[model samples]
Target: MGVIIVLIGMLLSVNLSIALDELPCHFLDSINITDGNRLANDDSIEFNGLVYSRKQYAEINYVLLRDGTDQITVDPYIRGCICNIKPCVRLCCPLGTLNTDDTDITVCQDHDKGNKFEAEVIHKNNETKVIPLERFFAYIEGIPCNFVYFDDDYQITHKGEISRGNLSTKLTHQNSCLHAGLNAETNEVDLRLLTCIELEGDDYDLNQYHVIRHQIINFCMLISVVFIVATLLAYIFIPKLRNLQTNCLICYLICLAISYSLVIFVTSFGYPSFACIPFGYFLAFSFFSAFFWLNVFNFDFWVDFQSKHRFKQMSERKKFYLYLVYGFGGPCLLILFIYILDNTVQLPPNMRPGIRDGACFISNILWYFYTPIGITLTINYVFFLLITLKIRKIQQDIAAERSQEDGSLMQKALNEKKETCILYLRLILVMGLIWIMEIVSYLMDNFSPLFLITDILNSLSGLFIFILFIVNRRVLRLIKERWQNLRGKATTNDNDTSNLISRSAAFMQMNPILTIK
Candidate 1:
């Protein structure tokens, strides 16, 4: 096992580096510098957080140097800005002053941050000294640098030229990505700044990036598969584990495993090549996993508050049916509703903006952003709040019962129940917090680096449930006791063998006469 793990790591490092080298350098190098250019032609410069249009730039001098340096390559001199300029047409006013024709101009500014604060470009066989916002039209037409920022750290100082039409933007900053957005109708280029930092000596290769992404995806898929296989075996072979499968944890595990299988199938086996099916499977199953885990959490309230009155005497089959109706069935209904919405409104699995790993993934759609996530979060939050209250009540009940009882086993049991309630409350509260953080992080932005944080929270959430449900002391003790009982029964049977032999001998002695005859 140790040797296998080491070999896998080695393979990943070597292959990943090789694959990264295969991806296009230009694609990876396109990081968005935030507010890269701010036009400030007027006397006073106003610093707004974003780029302003030509109309707004007329009155205000805006200083917009791009932020998000960690994600972008910075060249101090080359920057783009929006400014207002006067056209060729000029009007003679009544006061004998010529009013120049004002027009919107996108000015490409080049600055020397070094000792030479002034620079010039030879245009039309004339050397023109660079001035702030002067000859805006000519500068826009002539100057070279389209994107610019300062490099604080000397990682990649390779100076590159930008062709007039060559422009791109990073759609997302999740990983160091460079995506281009262009307006074909107007022939305008809009560069999108991203927040992903390219690693030093990072050679971008399309095939390599795809392979790395596939491997990481495969690794995560493998985790899901292992959990699924283990869960299946535990349920099928382990009698005790099988009997203990009444919680939401198992339901979540089952759903997650199924979801992963679906993803793996679509991505690898290509069973459902239809766009809608993969997205539906991804959303439905992922949400189901979350929903069921929350449903498990809802037990805090149900078991404590409504357990006695609602389903206390209900048959096991009825309970199973009820869960299936609400728990499993609800997600299915939701998927159906979403599908209907998609079909009617011309929306389904949203195709990602850029080419993905040869598979169409659900893009960040409006529905995913607001509707499903909002609904799931609300459900989980309400469930957690209600469960927390019930847990407190359970603890109180245990305490009250213990106080009334004398020094009997009943009192001890009540005390134990109190402790158990406390533990359950802590567990549920922690679980709720984890989900809250995940939902919050996800909703905030696509470029959030906190995805790793959310992933960690998810992993911990699973680990907590695993420990609580399967590895808890009480559960272990139950298994141990069952094993001991089995051994005891076997030992008794073994001892009875001696008695059986003696009884046989006695029977043989008594029947000796009869036997001889």
Candidate 2:
């Protein structure tokens, strides 16, 4: 693993608008002073007791210089903060205490009476030790480091994080990382992190960061569910908006809501009971249906624009009914097929949903869930490309037709419908991008809040849909008209009752002598 020295806050400002070829930041590997390959921007590194990737340090100044002294490089696929300095890492850990309550640092010295800092060490033989930092590095100088710290350190009680620069680190100030190649056996990157050894720290304290991350995610999920429900209610109450275009959206949102609600349930309460099995399958079915329905929406758009089609003979209502069968039914069929394979065949642990093994969330989410969604997304991408190219031809044809009739009423209506289709297309694109982030993060092994923004976006997708579909001028105007009509009906009923009472009284007066019980 190559270690790049990080300079915290010393960078000169340079215009970022320069051509990619001309821009000379630690971008050129040929000019890199470091004698080995550099770490990718996605690799995690720790500094000042906090763990994060170079990509996450957006505030840190990292002006790359032309000289070959900098170890950091701007990867074509990912970028990192660069510094022009010799690559070195501060090697230190919390000093040992007499006991859990001891307030004084119990200095453990070496042969020459030089100070020795306690560093956790785990060897290939599964033995763990709490020895001096210098000795520990000597032990791991030629091996892959994967130390899982336990509280059983014979002579050390790990307390605080590997921070406190004011504390003594003079012994490790000159320590530099050894260069190494990637280890393919364990699918592990040769990442030489300057972070502290993985120690048994306070679980709550260590977990608070992740807890807040999940809270943000849940908050957005609930917000989306609320808006999705609200959008459905609007359509349910206003019959005018329940046509083919909106129905497609409704089916997609319903599936999404089901999937989101199920996920929230699993995350919040967890599945410790027998109900887990059913919940897991239902969750998969709902999620797959959502993607299927989304694809159906995209397909409908593409098919409608096409001139020669079997569905062209049928009404919009008929086409939508057929779509419903495929959207919801197709996922149902997939779930059944999976259930059969799971029971009959001896599938690998990763291939089978862990629901059969009593796990709450579907175990091995990628193979079972993402594979199908990936296929759906691929199809959507192809359809989207075709749809975009097809729309231009549609606009031109419409323009010619309008000119022939000087913008007839039918042409005007077609234009308005075309505008709505464009809006829905934008909605599809937004959903696609947000979902793509989830897939990317999974592949990248998201361990930190570096990709928290993507989760936030995904969770709040319902709000985005609500804003796009329900909170628009067209839907709002329909709601206003519906309210006004209801009010007018009430007023008219009251007036009719009053007229009836007046007419009855006049009839009685005009025929007072002739009146009888």
Candidate 3:
């Protein structure tokens, strides 16, 4: 009976020891610093990091440990020890206080001396060795962490992540026009010997001088929204404006409006994961739709100039249907293809979406967004150039015909042709300029004055469209006529009301018994 009881006691002791040993250590990489900053005083956690710095003072000892994600200062105290001893003995430390530190370290904590903690240190062969407290925490080998790179302007340009043994990753700084080859190992990055390559063009500081630029862009977008709304209303209410050409313009305006609205929303509230999908989708779709409509416009303009008689013969409904397919349908297909690629393919760390410079934007701009836009813009620009040359030739022919003709009516017709040609030329020039600036800005990674110009022009695209198509002399005349008709109806109704009152008074006067009141 005694032997059985002793065996049972031994098994229970072994089980309890296993349970204590199995307790999980809290990893620094897993804990978000933003949330960890809010931890309660009584809560205990373990984290592992590389000891990057150490300071010894009469009062206390300070050690800075860097986990790939962040850094924290730890105060290692040896209880009941005086500074008189040349060799320090090891002791266990507890209840150390951590505060915030700001330096090259992404995030760091400063340890206060007021917190009482014990640490163990040993002296051997005239050298002092201390057991690493980090060993108590789990050691992370390779994991991704966000890195922010600031340019000369102090403006954030590149944001990405680096993991252990990632030596070939390239980081760019637009202001200096240089690229940094990262060497990462064992939860630390050494930027001491960076390789740089110079690029063309003088760089300017957007961070220092962006206030005025932002003001200009904001004003342009505000006016653009107003004009876009007005133009949309006119297209809906006016029957004469609902032709094939105007239909394409309406689609373009709708896409621009959606894009601009989303930009405002993201800049104001931010792009959290909860809102990222829908916001990213609509933003991309609108950009695609805008370019696709521009392509449709280029094609239509070419057809109109090349074969005016054939264009006139073609049914408006058929043209509208064709434009819809190319403008809306093409973008839809492209977006879907991108969506599939994003889901199936494994993306690099820098290409994945998350917080960048404290702002959330669609990641992988080169592959997912800019490539399609560049292709579309190239095709449209080619078409537009060809159309411009053709129209100029037509205008010259009309002028020559007018020179030979004797009638004033013929001269008037030639003048009208000249005006139409000039208008088309101006339209193409403005659109081309905006897109060219956009491409350049992206290529240069939005360096300086070029980026400023691109932002302003892009924001005011709606305003340009409204002025070119909606606020014309003919549209103004139509609006005036409509207003006059509405006023006439209103006045007529008021006069009819007065007459009915007069007739009622006459009837009451005629019938005295009926006028009892």
After superposition on all C-alphas, the RMSD of every candidate to the true structure, in Å, is 21.0, 22.0, 20.0
Q: Tens digits of per-residue lDDT for model 2 on 437-482?
A: 8888878866545468788998899999999888877678777766
What tens digits encode model 1's per-residue C-alpha lDDT throughout 97-118?
Answer: 2112111012122222211111
Write down the worst ten-residue block by lDDT for model 3. Answer: 50-59
Colliding residue pairs in candidate 2: none
TM-score of each: 0.46, 0.54, 0.54
Question: Candidate 2 — worst ten consecutive residues by lDDT sum?
Answer: 97-106
Query: What C-alpha lDDT, on a 0 to 100 scale, does residue 409 get in candidate 3?
Result: 43
Best model number under lDDT:
2
As for candidate 3, its clashing pairs are 90-120, 90-121, 91-119, 91-120, 92-118, 93-118, 99-110
- For every model shown, the clashing-pair count is 12, 0, 7
As a TM-score, model 1 comes out at 0.46
Once all C-alphas are superposed, what RMSD does model 1 give against the true structure? 21.0
